[model samples]
Target: MSPAETALPDLVDSHCHLDFPDLVGELPEVIARARAAGVGRMVTICTRLKNEPAVRAIAEAHAPVFYAAGTHPMSAAEEPLATVGELVALARHPKFVGIGETGLDYHYTAESRAIQQVSLRLHIEAAQETGLPLIIHSRDADQDMEAILAEGMARKPYACVMHCFSSGPRLAEAALEMGFTLSISGIAAFPKSQELRDIFLRTPLDRLVLETDSPYLAPPPHRGKRNEPAYVAHTARALAPLFGLSLPEFAARTTANFDRLFPRAAGAQQAA
Candidate 1:
């Protein structure tokens, strides 16, 4: 049988994008499949400030779903910078467990470097104030990413996670040193990702979490297909042995890690 069909233990998809067109209309079915595959919980990340309402509603409508919203790095320049006050207010909602999937992304929009940096700092402030973990998306700009995160953290420490962590070892170490978490995505499960998997292996077990990054980065047997929370199993299975744990143990470890970083999620309200 293919990796996709491998049995999975109960898990939480620490990050996903159920608000995007790819999953929104089919949400109920999408969620059902996720549950069936042992993906018992998910945090749907909203990349744009403008779409917070829609994303929030998705969380409210589904009992197992929680949501977070912030300006994505790639869209930072096009959108207005976020403020700490605004984000803190949003965090009042019980299900708003995380802040910004906000970080540097020079891969596609290097021209917006200045604007992105400004936006990123603001999101950092928001996370600092709200006391919610910042969900970062670092890409080709590892140097700047490391510098800025360190600078902000120096001023005031805050919880953070390197969402979809796929950068070089330097950035990984920087994030890890700062007491931040590194999320494991399908990229870690890809056959050619020995280097990436090595980074995860070196990370402290307590600081690792799992995510699907749904509608993208599908794991083996599902790679190149639209990813969903259900496929998180394949990625989890790939890393379990590397950690010398059974799939159930790895799932529990990651899910417990998620609960620590996102306390609001475990006890979120049933409806909005």
Candidate 2:
């Protein structure tokens, strides 16, 4: 099938770094491209609490663009850990719909485990306070990630999403058991990512979210270039056959998942 004829659904790029260098300078064009490509909505994820004003500005600049507030696990070492009050306060903004891009990562040695945990806990507390979902990123620390999330979820009920999920089935099972949603990224579209695709196919659509993790992980045909929200269409195409759903159906289901997790977005969608 030609790239454009793959029959993309009205997908959502649930996680992206639109505020980063590649797209920030031309957000108008970037968003236009995404809209043209049938991306119905997107979440410009936050990697640092301190940069939230910038994040909010981007979200506020355009319709269907929402912001998330939290520090990335790798950024925890460079940025000050977010406190519960700070995170809660930031997330209270109307344009802010979630708390995270935070979780565990041992992929890089730049951050210590202690710092990541502290930040993760604060973000979780913020999610509890604001009733927003928590976005999580984990790598090579499944045991610690599971333990910390288990501990935090015990304190209060809160929504959580394992963003850019690349963990084993055990971690996936645990996260699902704790009521956390699992987001599949464009990595699933790669030839070597069959295992990831297998897991994604097995995952229930009700608890599944599709993300591009844009400015990175662009799916096939655009795999080597910096990704944008528009490329999320590629993920939906890649996912269709695996799940036995038509493209439009896949899009509708994932978009529904997005709305369910971010109630504020659901409200906005309804009002619009």
In the range 1-272, model 2's lDDT, one tens digit per residue, is: 76645654577889999999988998888988888788878899989877888889888878879989788998888898788888878876888888888988888943488888888888888888889999999999999999989998888989989999999988899998998899988888899998887777777889998898889989998988999999988888888878888788888888899889988877365112
Q: Largest lDDT belongs to which candidate?
A: 1
State the TM-score for model 1. Answer: 0.95
lDDT of each: 0.90, 0.86
Q: Per model, how many backbone clashes are there?
A: 0, 0
TM-score of each: 0.95, 0.94
Clashing pairs in 1: none
Given candidate 2, what's the lDDT at residue 272?
Answer: 21
Q: After superposition, how far is residue 120 of candidate 2 from its true place, in Å?
A: 1.0
